[model samples]
Target: MSVSVMAATAASTTVGTPWINITIFGAFVAITLVVVLRASRNNKTAADYYAAGRSFTGPQNGTAIAGDYLSAASFLGICGAIAINGYDGFLYSIGFLVAWLVALLLVAELMRNTGKFTMADVLSFRLKQGPVRVAAATTTLAVCFFYLLAQMAGAGGLVSLLLGINDKVGQSLVVAVVGAIMVLYVLVGGMKGTTWVQIIKAVLLIAGAFVMTIWVLAIHGFNFSTLLGAAAEAGGAAVLNPGLQYGLTDLSRLDFISLALALVLGTAGLPHVLMRFYTVPTAREARRSVVWAIWLIGLFYLFTLVLGYGAGALIGADRIKAAPGGVNSAAPLLAFELGGPVLLGIISAVAFATILAVVAGLTITAAASFSHDVYASVIKKGKAAPGSEVKVARITVVVIGIFAILGGIGVQGQNVAFLVALAFAVAASANLPTILYSLFWRRFSTRGALWSMYGGLGSAIILIAFSPVVSGTETSMIQGVDFHWFPLSNPGIISIPLGFLLGWLGTITSRTLENPAVAAEMEVRSLTGHGAEGATDH
Candidate 1:
């Protein structure tokens, strides 16, 4: 049968059940509760809440970094891409893992040496407060929104697939439970507690992925060649080489390149991932931790390819294509099919944990930007009492959590990969340039940072909101209206360049207004691990 016919049939059959998902979700909440309660007690200081008092060790921080970086997109989207598109799906994993090189060499150590709570502090280190705050908050919120959407959408899909619940209830529950846990972590456990939660989740996800990989490989007697051949036979060679089927079309190539740029470059710019580096006590430890993270991330991704292809071979792409969720159902359905009900339950639970850990990281990072940068700095002129900043940060966490849940519940029918790519493009466009300029360019000024943030962010949003991928006005007040501002769905190609250009222009315009004293202090602090070195800069 053709792939389309198989997919149509899969959507009609309720092949797998959802009870195991609910049971595992309960356990996730319980464990998270214990961690939150423990972390809350020691979060009396801003440093503790914001940077985990900068006390985490390498391995611990490494796992947490993995936890922060590995979102539902990596788990579900990549798997589906591979099952549906073959090697092109695996390309996402390669690009994602490769971006760490930039982070490790360019960002990891420097971020630790520069900012206190958020990336805004680093970008605004030498600039004026208002512009810095606005830019930082904008970048933080943009990335968080898209990232949260992907996670929430994934949650809805997972719940629907595993427990047989509708998308609305499944997504809302994920947001509610995840939001609550994240608020608790920020409010109660603070950074220390949140780091632990990430570590635990990362371990579970990797272990779970490995178990599934091994089970699948064993079922085929550990022969990778045979596995690929089987998958190809079942799904056709095009599934292994998406280019074979779609490469001839310019539109398809553009889509592939857009997604690749977002996945590769965006990883270094994600606030949640960057925030984790600050939790380490020293810049050196932060660098070392990334090494561990790279290894862990690479291993996990390598295994996912096996899992995806193995699922294609064993569970049969036809079976997955016939499922309601199409390619997205490949992972769980294969889990249930190959490992039976017990393994199926475990896979569902692990998937839920992946979403929870990822969303919690994104929510906390956004909250930190609001509380530490916007509230503590802008609203109070940096005079908000010692613990007031942390208090405000916690409150902001709760507020952001409510919004994330609402947003997740709202964007229900969107494609999971598309949602994730939007976050990446926005991150690369708005945040990356400002951050790079702040770190490397001595001439970078407050105006330059602000313009880059707003310009890149604005351009990307305008383009994406109107892009054919988002389906701009068909669902709006007007009926039978359709428009696509951009032919290609992804905007990283243009948005990322816009950011770099804006930063350059802003720097040239504001050269004379740059603060020499603050710039010198920031330079020293960013180069060295002395938060105390640039105390006067703030």
Candidate 2:
């Protein structure tokens, strides 16, 4: 068949019924509600709500980490990428795994040792709380909102495609469902509930992907080479090699680099992920949790490669493009094709689980930052008791959920993968450098940390606003906004460095004013996890 005819034929295949999808999705929601309700009783204390009461063991924490990290971008986006873009898409898996290594080796233990709740807790180790809190909260809210937008967008796309709803309606529904479940989880179940939900989701996602991978290969005559050859023949050279779509050369290469930076550096900086470390009681447990998380992440990402390539070979690019919602539908669509109706139904349920699980995690994290960092620490000066803190967190979860739904409904047509990358760039730029320097750099002062956070945050936001994806500009948004200002789609290339530069300059300019006695106590607390109160210079 001619490629055009093959594409048309592939596009015309009927998917499963909308009612079937909605029924399955409804069941998933019921399960989450039950879990959240059961967990909420234990969430009375702020520690319980914000950090799961520091109760999870290493392995449980590891699973939750996997659940938290494996967002829609990993499941839907990567598979779609693989189906449409070929092996180049698998590169994301590599970048994510490499990033965890940094997390495990560098930040995990230190974060657990120093900070009580948010990234700001760590950066404010020696600084006056006022400037650090303001900067940290600004970065946290911005990062969470940007990241939530992508997840919300993904949830909308997933629901719309699977259930055949209008995109805006689908997004709104997704936002509401996710927001409700997460609010309950944080309000009732708190940290413990969120952790378990994450663990369960990780297991479901891995099992579902494994089942789909097997079916995909079986349909391809169980031959790996045949799969690649078929994918190549089907997609042409663009699919076979790392072509322009993979961003291997020139402009595309820059885009690729930006994505890599976001995935690698951004993981460590995310408030949600950092907060998970605090859930572990001790620094050693935190370290072990990350070690296991890296392995799980590696294994799951590996399966995505098969799912992506398998879809490419069996389902074809034309069909994926013509899918209800572009390439994001490739995995589910492929499931139906390979395993027929039963498998389609099962995979549809799994996809719903993926969305709910990811959204729950994101909402809880955002809530924690709002309540713990902004509300309790900055506004109340950490005066609230653990019980009151938990109550506040629950309320914030509901409020944040509403905002997420609104944002999700508003940006229904946006590319979630692109949004996720922007989140990463912002986190890496605004949060990571400050935390790292504060922990290890003795010369770093309050002024230095404050300046770094502001500089990084400003650069990332400005760069992203002008980015092609957000600005709707025809120019390579990074390249077109005047090369003199920003040169990459992701701002880590510029913003991260700028953060460090500002911090260094701020410290040097104010070296005489630096307080030695306060610095020593901050160092001890940050490195030892000894003092939760009275370390504040605020």
Candidate 3:
């Protein structure tokens, strides 16, 4: 009754056509459109557009945060990795789950109490608004750009595979449709619509995973050891070990550590994730939301472990490798093999919803950075009309969505999980240091914040551009060219230290002028929520 035994017995069964998947996916799209239309009715002010008027209860915001954090990269990419690399793929899940501890303990309440709408609000609270806002906005866009590239590429591949379209034109069309829908979500529903979408997706995603895991276990007579043993047999003995994919040699070990560092530290710096804290009504609510998010996210990842190992056990690595996107198609194929067309269609729809919800969240955060942080705070000196700011945010969403479509089409076939790791590296290098110093160091100055943001941002981009991922490897975009100069694909180890060093250098070398009064006020507000944004119902 093990999945492998079942797969062997049922190998000759005919699978259903792509039209079933299309029908399910279309239904999801229709539901999302209705959600956005309903949410748009209340998006009249800046607060409503950017922070959902700070009215979400703790549990609601927590589910939204889970939806935002568990992107296509997490649901599909991580599962794919596990199907291919076995135990090594589970390492990414562990890193991601552990990072939430940092967010829950250090950042959740602090960010909620100090910031109004964006990460810039917290960083610029005790620093110079103009320079700090500019630097923070720059980093936010940078993180979102790389993150969107990965999600959109995954979106295109998923759409193409599920719809049985094998051509580049078909993939491009899928990206366009996804981009347009994401734009609609942000421009019309704003945070309220996006949050609801995320909540619904999170529920569906978790429920889907739970059902799949139970089905997998039932096939194995509810024996965990039987499942693990079968997976090892299908994937070979190396699949159960650490060095199969990421941790082979000295250099690879260093790279693995660097990737772990980025994943652990980067969550705290992610602007979209940080912005979720502001949607709740109070600092206490924000704290509770993080706890709720931690539980939900942890449960989902546990289910992912079962899905991954079961896929490897049931689908076989050779067959998974021969699929369209190789291991990326493992989970979908497993669903087909297990429950035929119906479960496959459901899983495909969930994957599509995952991409849409994540991209919408990223779009809103990037738009908020441009409008709330840069336009309203920097260009207008905080005097921009609320209506005008919201209008600018809507326009920015369209622009960002268009750019993401082009980028996704351009980077098709790339490993989405790798690209996501790069995005995390940039966030860790550029944003985390600035956030930590801005919150903790009394001597942290505007000059330090700027150097931390720019230095980290510059180093991450430069290193990634020269790394083997771009050109040296067979899996790279331009595989024939070998112009890679950077040894490690992830730049976290070097760039993170450099960010801290530059911040210290800038602070000590610059003028000794310090704003003790503002620091004191920020500290008081962050701890007590005395002057933080209030709930809309209040």
Candidate 4:
């Protein structure tokens, strides 16, 4: 689209009063801040600050998990992707939802039964502490930082579009503001407060999507075929096929497999999602929570099928690509088309809430890994003064918020879902192998843990840094640069296998043997929730 045509598109979208959107965003911020303040009162201990004292019921924590899991990528990016790419886009929804089954069957209850505050606790239980903790914390920070980037970028685009601020500077400022608010939520309310925000956001998000889905269906006389027919009529029959986005080349097809691997395996290793398991009391609650999360998340993704096609049918793919926020503008634009300004404002607020809740969850998880795993355990040798670790965590939150703001600003126009997939790839590569080994493999050693984490992490980052996603293509983060050497956009296919192999090699090659007794103890504890919450030595 040309500049004149783009301006007309923007003018039409911005016909809904921008101030109304601003008011809605501001009101959400004020209310959530108040909730954070109220939740902060009982955050007097590290357990309270980190795990909410394990007081949340199964259903409550489950709802918060849904809130954290269903990010801006699910609502904005998936819708926009489907609007543009058709069948290929809905694959993201499938990959994300199927990931929960991994969490449920393999990870959730086992992790909750064995670990206390963080995943490091579970890994370091039977292994050497210092090297393992440091490696675990490093990988945790890496995953959380990448995840934060996606949420922050989504915030920037959504707000800039709502306020009609087309300039990059305005969007950067919007991202910075979001980072600051996220920092406050972590510093004050801690996990408890972040959980509340996520619960509220999740409810609003699913509710909002439900209403919009019904509205879109009703507009087409409550017929599913009519909605799909309209989408085909507007775009083409190609919208109904399998090869819309990833079928252009053999390399792109490989990239899709890499992306699928990352998405399906990544959630099992995500630090923020892993930390959520600690918020509940027992293995049973963790199991219940995952079940709840799976059902709720599945229902919401079904809504996306309607919402995405609805946007494609009503807004048209070309216009969405030319809109203020590019592909990320689909859901909000669909709202504007369906109910004008009022619906636009409400939908925008919900999207921002999704961004805020997810970022805050990521922030707290990153900070906890640093303070709990690195500072308190590695640096202080588990003898840190009371309340001092939490103080250090608060400081780390500020530093992380700053970096997330800068990173988000740099990757403004990228798709939030694609960015999240990169995070997933990193998680799958760096963390998943180590986690599975520690929990299930009896001979997994500290050397094995360290090797798997650093090898997987280094390879994933190196590949991403040199991939077309970063510099080669027009839509790359760094446009006008051709430094990329990697052909594939995602590195999961290469890095994830390397992680597993390195772990096995390091364990077998280590001169010192691990104690069989400790491994057996861990197996018993992991399987039967024996000493998770009660054990204080970790």
Identify the superior model by TM-score, candidate 2 or candidate 4.
4
- The Cα error of candidate 1 at residue 531, in Å, is 4.4
Clashing residue pairs in candidate 3, if any?
none
lDDT of 4 by residue, 105-217 (tens): 99999999888899899888888888899999999999999998888888988988888877888889988988888888889899999999999999999999999999999
| Candidate 3 local lDDT, 91-139, one digit each (tens) | 8899999999999888899999989899999999888888889999999
The models' CA-based lDDT, in order, is 0.77, 0.74, 0.86, 0.91
- Candidate 4 stretches greater than 4 Å from native: 1-8, 12-15, 536-538
| Candidate with the greatest TM-score versus the true structure | 4
Model 3: residue 25 alpha-carbon error in angstroms: 0.6
Native-to-model Cα distance after best TM-score fit, residue 111 in candidate 3, in Å: 0.6
- The prediction achieving the highest lDDT against the true structure is 4
Per-residue lDDT value at 462 in model 4: 96
Model 2's lDDT to the true fold? 0.74
Put down candidate 1 lDDT per residue, 47-106, tens digits, no spaces: 777788888898889888888777777777777778777887787788889989988888
* Model 2 stretches astray by more than 4 angstroms: 1-14, 166-185, 246-249, 385-387, 473-488, 511-513, 521-538
Q: What TM-score against the true fold does each predicted structure earn?
A: 0.92, 0.91, 0.95, 0.98
**TM value for model 2:** 0.91
Report the Cα lDDT for candidate 3: 0.86
